[model samples]
Target: MTYLNGVQVSSAAVSTDPLSWLDERASERTDAGLRRHLRVREPESPAIDLASNDYLGLVRHPEVIEGAIAAVRRWGAGATGSRLVTGTTADHALLETELAEFVGAQSGLVFASGYAANLGAVTALAGRGALVVSDAGSHASLVDACRLSRARVEIAAHRDVAAVERLLAERTEERALVLTDSVFSADGDLAPLTELHRACRAHGAVLVVDEAHGLGVRGDGGRGLVHEQGLAGEPDIVITATLSKAFAAQGGVVLADARIRAHLIDAARTFIFDTGLAPAAVGAARAALGLLRRDPTMATRVLDRAADIARIAGVAEPDSAVVSVVLGEAQLAFDAAQTCRARGLDVGCFRPPSVPTGTSRLRLTARANLTTAELDVIAEVLSEVLADARGTERISA
Candidate 1:
């Protein structure tokens, strides 16, 4: 008790100051016209929606909604604990089982989100001595997962199998994990997954493919890119997907061999520590999957819509359900988005940090449920917006 009260402080509270660092960051973003904002939208709003990831348009299906409502009623409002504890419900198990079977995997594990699933898969599989070969154009979540895994990461050029093969040949490490996205999110371009898989096999490395955008847009009956590439049941390949995108629900899943699934269930900290996906999401996704299995037309419709958007908007030919309309500068991109908004259309605006500098574009994700008339309206509004934005840019310059 040597003078314990000597350092007693005053009772008055310290003044709260706004963080200047954050203000500066915000100012920089604003100056670059890259500031983002959220708009409240209603279910049946007249605004044409091309900014969402619901490519298959299953979010508002009667069956999907009913499944969500029923699951909430049956399993309560929330998952009460971590999946390892009291959170895992029958719905979750059913979804996992059905997903594995549909995707031709030996087993599957579900996670709270796609980002979490990627983290869990990457960190668990690629350990301290392992090397992770990633594509430079991969999703941010996958890049973060690689960085967090404490493994040596070599980012090859986008879809460059030759570069990957060269890196793998040079690496002395015996173990490597090659990661790529089946469909690049920003540009909606498909990776040469078949070629990558061959390279992975030649190098004796495991392949981790993120099927986030391809699940309901590619493959036979929406099984996914891996299925299309004939790698679905391969022991050296694993696939990760998000229920939120095509399924219009909230969850992530990893499909792989039975042994790897077991390892994830036991060793993946993200799975152990995070709360399980909601019962409603599980049910909704299950329903959506079932519908996709039965209808199959949903997938084709989405592809058609994406191609239509590209042709009508006079943009680069789309490879999938995402069409990007190039805008020269960040301010022009922002103005184009605003112009579309004013004309009762909703579209995604990509600028620096998201897209590379000087390559700003309007990222439009088309949905299957959108009609031809709606597409016509979208094209008209977008054309007008781009023209107006260009005029404004010329005036400013």
Candidate 2:
């Protein structure tokens, strides 16, 4: 027997046809209601969008558009090369400075995407001899980072500070890193930042918080939950955030102590090897940051919208802009999403691997600019679909 992509197969079976096993896997997925396909969205969509991560609705703001255009005109389309090479432009430096200052960090380093930033930070900070205590509910990028770090990993119970502290206290390794998401992506719940940080401090471990979902929707004026908890700029705490979400740009950043920043510059392969973030993305993010500074009310508006969505969907109040409605079966979630689309609403359906085995759900994002009419439309569509789902369940029972 041999392992092929984690599935064990007899050598004889593999020798017959190397690609034949894919057909069986495909059939299994089809039967499980786990098959997925991509659809192209219209450029001028008529649907009320509740699927995107543009929490602040700055993607098309006039200043954001002008920032992209100006960057293209001044710095060309791309960063030209990796940051270590010729990709580090003046815009990149300026953006880094502004991001560090805005997030209350001593320094910052930009990466191609949030995934890369997480991977770079985790791997660079926790290596083969270190112990990595990770939250079980962390984003996939962080999970992958732990794997790549080749460290002794301990997955603490989700949001359980006691479990994390236990792991940290029992670990034999002197160097340890605790990893978690500030705002969980699927259920939109928040981590206990204060308790987690306290535990890390007690154990003398560094805490790495991914603020991808928290940066644009939490804290005072969206400085982020870390800043809100007075953990920003702490020597033992590091933050990794995505520019693609609230910033409405396309990159990632690691904000940390100045010493950590220098370490990542020298050790993080993702930053050293990947091409620098596009010039347009850097410019757009900078512009969005400026807008947020000018209009702090946008952050509050997004949370209010999320609360409205949760009330309409009859789910728990959201901790962030993401409101998830659990629908049980994958097929039910897919059908409900399609029904909403038919009613001129665009929402996300997350099944199987994206969520836990039994919690297929409708993932809705609250945008700052979503109007009352759009909220009403969403509520109406959701109510009808949920009623139908219940009816089907009763009949099946």
Candidate 3:
């Protein structure tokens, strides 16, 4: 037996075949209903889109498209290099400044994707010997960041403020960070930001909140939950967000204190080593921000639609644009999603390990532009599909 990366493997087994094990793993996943496949979508889909994260429906808006086109015309197709090297353009600098001002942060830094932003922020804020107390339901990127931080990580119960406070108080490390998502991705539930902030303050820990689902839907004029809670400019608080969802663009931003921004610029490996956000994405995001600023009603429209969907689906009102309908099993959830698709509606299916075991669900996202006619169609389709799922469940039992 030999040890590789802390895992013991028999030499005979390694000698037999290295890639063969993957086939067995794949079969196991198939049997467990954990296999995933991608479906190619047409440029102009005929179905009412409930699977996409375009909460504000600005992806193809004339202004957003023009923003991208104009950027490509001016800055070419790519950023060309890492920000520290040669990629930081005037557009990037402008977007960063605008994003900071919008969120009431002292400074902001942009990354190629939200995943990179989360990774950079978490790892940079809490490193070797530091303590990281994260919520159990944080996004996968944040979870991965905790693992990579080389810190003593303690995962508190989901949305349990007292658990987080205990972890912070008991930590041996002098420096600690409390991490959570402002709006959880799967269930669309909100975090207790006020209580979490108070705990962080009492324990002398920094708090990092990922507002991927909160931005453009929670705060006044779509600033975000941090701004809504009046914690925007707090020195101990940091915010990370994605432009892909509500902004309908492709990038991420880390809003923090000026000192933290400078430190990340110097030490965040994902930012310093990875190529900067593309010029087109930066331009599109900036344009989307401008549109939101000019017409804050777009944010309210998304919430109204989400509430309407929740009513139709008989689910609790969502805190954001995402509404989840629990179907209880993977195959049932997949069947319901397919049924909805067949009826001219496209909804998302979530199975384990994306969600906890026994909590498979249909994930639906609301768009601000969905018309009354479209909502009626979605309502009818979901009602029929859910009824069928219940019948099947009763028969199986």
Residues 1-397 of candidate 3: C-alpha lDDT, one tens digit per residue? 8876789988665545778879999999888777888888899989999998998899999999999889999999999889899848999999999999999999999999999999999999898889999999999999999999999999999999999998888888989999999999999999999999999999999999999999998899889999999898999999999999989899899999999999999889999999999989988999999999999988899999999999888789998999999989888888788889988999999898889988999999998899999988877787778878877422111
Clashing pairs for model 1 are: none
Q: Backbone clashes in each candidate structure, one number apiece?
A: 0, 0, 0
The digit string of per-residue lDDT tens for model 2 on 1-397 reads 7987899988776655778889999999998889999899878899998999999999999999899889999999988788998747899999889999998999999999999999999999999889999999999999999999989999999999999999998999989999999999998999999999999999999999999999978998999999988888899999999999999999999999999999999999999999999999999999999999999899999999999988877778898999999999999899889988998989999998999988999999999999988887877777777778667322111
Worst 10 residues of 1 by lDDT: 388-397
Badly placed stretches (over 4 Å) of model 1 are: 1-18, 390-397
Off by over 4 Å in 2: 1-16, 392-397
Which tens-of-lDDT digit does each residue in 30-91 have in candidate 1?
A: 99888887777786888888999998888899999999999999998888889788857888
RMSD of each: 4.8, 4.0, 3.7
TM-score between candidate 2 and the true structure: 0.95
lDDT of 3 at 227: 95
Residue 94 in model 3: shift from native, Å? 0.6
For candidate 3, the 10 contiguous residues with the lowest summed lDDT are: 388-397
